[model samples]
Target: MPGQENMTDVTVIRGNVYERLSHVIDPEIGRSVTDLGMIVAIDVAPSHSTEGVRAPGRFDVTVHVELTVPGCPLTQTIQDRIDEAVASYPGLELVPHIEVGAMDADKLTGLVSSLKAERRENPFNKPGIKTRIFAIASGKGGVGKSSVSANLAATFSALGYDTAAIDADIYGFSLPGLFGVHSQPTNLNGMLMPVTAWGVKLISIGMFAGADRAILWRGPRLQRSLEQFLSDVWWGQPDVLLLDLAPGTGDMAISVAQALPNAELVVVTTPQPSASDVAVRSGLVALQVPLKVRGVVENMSYFDHAGERLRIFGEGGGTRVSDRLTDALGYDVPLLASLPLEPDIREVGESGRPAVLDSDGSLADTPLASSFTALARRLIG
Candidate 1:
């Protein structure tokens, strides 16, 4: 009688197993393996009644998983998640047996085709999309615009926002080096997957090799590069998108405004007067386009030494920029933050990590980290 009930339970579990596994998403594709036709077969049978092998009425679930390609980088991770899902089935003792294989050429092609058809156009361009786009700009180079973009992206991700960044500084891209992403993106058909590092999805020209770079860099114009990044890649509608724009107030800013009409500008400047003057001009570009000037960030504003806050780069450059922009644009542009000029900022950044974030991708407790966290919150709010 007990064995008969166990059989009924197993019958119900067959459908339940597939439902449970549907939640396991492939990190690269951002879709469930079950939806992608990766789970080829799931055979469920009664476990042997042998002593000490498994509890009575237990079932052995053998799951056949077919990957999109052989030698996939995340093969082990996918296998482990499948095992956990089966082994921890609720109210039953389920022993999981997973078989891994690659999808046949025809099946793989069909899957890729289905995805491309479903996502034919840029998801962000659609109406009523809730993604907040931030364009980091500076009037001139050496004002630490890229550093602010990188750290701000890291901070947004660490705070649990789905974040993505574009190294729009195409001619002088540095996000690949800053994020330390040496590996190439996974190319599924013509759509490329962004490399996730420090919890932020990133795409940069530096990540591509000779031929691959050339294909993406077709047309050799600033606006074209930004268009390719937006349309060609599978961005999956991130909650926050940050762009590290090229310095000196012209083509790139106009391109971003034209492309992303809702984008807000965040100006970065130093405490020095030379940098502040240029920085104000950078934010003033908002007047020409429909872009909103969000706020200003002052980098290299001070140096902390032996319990003393030293104004190494002079003071009030951030306020000056913000005040000038407010008067010119007739809108109050506030000074969001003033970051310190610590040696670790450069050293850690060069080592391929955002200094405001810890090694484990959490916000650090230092002043710099706090500054970024606050700035991110204010910008989003």
Candidate 2:
């Protein structure tokens, strides 16, 4: 019965290893390693002392993994995940030896083909998609729309939600600069992996420079670029997706509505009649399209100076836009947030990080972060 018991033990251990690995998700693909055909083989063997005696309750596990891409930037992350999963096995001392390599041409081709087939067309446009699509738009420029989008996205990510953002403003793209993402997305067999910055997955034309940037702007229509961003890029399934649309009432908002039928529009405006006047027009696009006007955000509503909340940009602009849009659209378009005119929003943001996020990437404990967190929760609800 000793031989049979030994076989049984090994079988149970192998099964347990597989179970642990099932929870290890690929950072980019958002699928388990087991599901992605990454786990080529799992070999479990009992450990032996130098004297050739079997060590009880101890084993050596060799996992042969074939990554989808060669020399993936996140290879170390995957390795760390696998190591943790193996080393933390319950009630046993297991040493993991991971054998990492890239999928060969044929294997990679099959994987990509399978993934593309499963993805089909734009995944977000499909019915019953769980992703909450928020298109952040503003009637005019300099309203900190991009800044709001970046901070909101960062807040969502810090709050433990999977978040992604698209800089839908192709001509005046600023997300790449705000998030401080300088590297282009990894192109794997025509599929682009969004650059992860400030805990948010982001894609923007600004990520491309020189000729590539020019090419995106040259011949294709605005709608076409938006379509490519939706269809061509692999977004996986983020809990929230924010699109920082170009300022002014333009085709981008309409394009978003046409492309993403489930998108909700959040208008950004300063606390002044001039900005709020146009901000109302941005939300009014909901009438032209079937999109819903989510709410309004008043950026730079005040400046905190010497125990006084100074109305630097005036007031009631967000309320005015909200009331106007609510009256026009026949729904409650409440003002979601009134962000302050904090200098860090621009200075620190220009340094390539969301001002709402502290250096550690967590939401800061400032009033700004608190307002954004509340705004994020409200939008989700």
Candidate 3:
């Protein structure tokens, strides 16, 4: 009779249970279960005892859950969250009976439609929005533009600022690998979720595969892909969005300028004249578009050897690019940082983590991290 008693008690307290479940958020979507229409129904019933009678102080609380997708990778996480939510009810002895199922086509379609409608256009381009967009560009390949982008993004996230990144280098995408993200973005209806790694939300063409990559790669190669990355993926209004642009002074920069009018340009160049010369040209793309040249980052400026800073790639490339961009853009395009060439940057990056961040995704207290932290602060400030 304990089951009957507990069941009877839960029936009266089911409203309170619903309220508690409302606080349980769907981690992937960042929305509460109730808000996402995940909690379809709850049935409170008595547990049968061996004697064919209701067990005393025992109840089977069956929670009907309609997930957005069947076989979702995060399904167990959601279920665990729901179990925790149910167990949190004070002074109640209840066994959770979670019945998981996918949302019906019509309901899923409606939910996606509602979310899309609420989002409207790209949140970054909206007036008074707070996201700071920085497209990291280089004139030539091998200037460490992607490295700078990945590290800067990790630094931002480590500093407690919400950050996101895009591997806008469609042909030479690298963020996914740098961030060690092998998982694909979750597709909620037609909308794609950005994969979160290194405490930063990220999306890249590299995260897509076969038909998915083809679907996302639809439309004109350059602009449309950038636009889709902007318009299609759910970025959630990150405080900073970094784009590791393709190494060139061409279409990607123009596409970024058009898609994200508020985006600033952060040109990445080596300390060598050859790299800096092209780096300057890359920043010059701002002149062609209405984009602001934020600053210049001089990577591989030096190699530290026994307290001596060795300028392996030659010096002053950052300054030259900064000076050129300032004059051409008529703005204060300062040289933000001169990051030393470190082998660990490549080694750790190859291992699928940003060099600026420790294993815990926090900024390591090394010189490299400090440099990136300062760079991030300067850009934000």
**Overall lDDT per candidate, in order of appearance:** 0.86, 0.90, 0.86
Candidate 2 lDDT, tens digit per residue, 1-381?
767887888899999999899999988888999998899999998999999999999999999999988878889999999999999999999999999988888887787788889898788978789999999999989999999999999999999999999999887889988999888887878888889998899999888757244433433488888888888788898999999998877777778888998999999999989999999999998989999999999999999899998998789999999999999999899999998888999999999999999999998989899989999999999
Off by over 4 Å in 2: 1-7, 49-54, 209-220
Off by over 4 Å in 1: 1-7, 49-57, 211-220
Better model by TM-score: candidate 2 vs candidate 3: 2
- Full candidate order by TM-score, most accurate first: 2, 1, 3
For model 2, state the Cα shift of residue 17 in Å. 0.8
For candidate 1, the TM-score is 0.91
Steric clash pairs (candidate 1): none
The model with the greatest TM-score is 2
Residue-by-residue lDDT tens digits, candidate 1, 242-355: 999989776778888888988889999999899999888898888889999989999998988998989988999999999999999998899998888878678999999999
Least well predicted 10-residue stretch by lDDT in candidate 2: 211-220
Error of 1 at 85 (Å): 1.9
User: In candidate 2, how many Å is residue 1 off?
Assistant: 8.3
Predicted structure 3: lDDT: 0.86
